[model samples]
Target: MPLGVVIRRQPGVTRWAKWVWRAVAVLPGAASADWQELRREGEAVEYHAATLPLTVYRSETEAYRIVLAAESPSVFVVLHPSEEASPDRPYVVHSVTVSAHEAQQALDSGEELVEPVPMPPPLYAWLADFVDRHHADETFMKRKRGPAVEMQSEDGKGDARIRQAADVYRSPASRRKGELH
Candidate 1:
């Protein structure tokens, strides 16, 4: 399956803080993955996977506002904080929704699917740069030139050398040159 990855930044929010909040919210038997942290513009960014395959960010304001958007879609949402806290926190301040059809249309038209909202420009730029920086470097990969060699000794044979005549020139051996000593 083709996964759409969205990069988001919650100003003044730390990844650990969000993790703590998520741990408190998600009950047992809920399918979830640990949040992954990324650094952009010297600030830590946290991302968690959702059932809708969406990325969420909590606003910095104490109002508990949030921004939700499809990372790969042109759609996004900024929702405001809600009075009651239910299974899901309703602190969405604004939201942007981009339809899959719209995203496909943009791709067909050779346009960028990601559209920036009223977020920090530097953050977006940093994300773009970070993605570029992390792309695998395929240039260093090359085909293998040769196979490894296996070394072994013959069944019962071993390395041996003949003794030189001058080295074995003892009196008794010299007298019986061609004879066995």
Candidate 2:
């Protein structure tokens, strides 16, 4: 079945906090090797894969926006149905949240499994645009300083620039005694 995965913003989360949360959300659980494989692609370090088929969406009540069902509370696993299965039909499967250690244990015991969800058209487009907009371009990544210019001093050494200018430019009568006019 086709599953829609969503990560909703949590309450009292600042913009920076949201970014951190998103970063955490993308991290692969203890048992998932898919994330490691995905990281082998171009700039894969920035991409995080969902451990479970779980979709997270924000609730209207502003509580528990990050939701996923895993065997343990800390690890989430993706469940993929058979290719011939219709998405419209509901399938019987257990969805529960479990801990990271427990998830690792399951994987170690040879019970870890995953089903890759095909990227939806809209999501694929969105991800493409997002990467294009956010990824730093190589050309701009290199730092370059602009050329520096030398400034000319108005006065020579030991010359009072202000007084000299005033004396050179001011009328004789306007000049004060012992002072540069």
TM-score of each: 0.21, 0.20
lDDT values for all models: 0.33, 0.32
lDDT of 1 by residue, 1-181 (tens): 1122223444435764541221111111224333333333444343432212333222211111112133321233323334674323423322222233333444465423334333334433433344344434345667787876645423323234545443342444234447554
Model 2: per-residue lDDT, tens digit, 26-59? 2322343222332322322323233344332222
Candidate 1 global Cα RMSD: 21.2
- Poorest stretch of ten by lDDT in candidate 2: 58-67
Best by lDDT: 1
Model 2: residues with Cα > 4 Å off, grouped in runs:
1-77, 80-111, 137-181
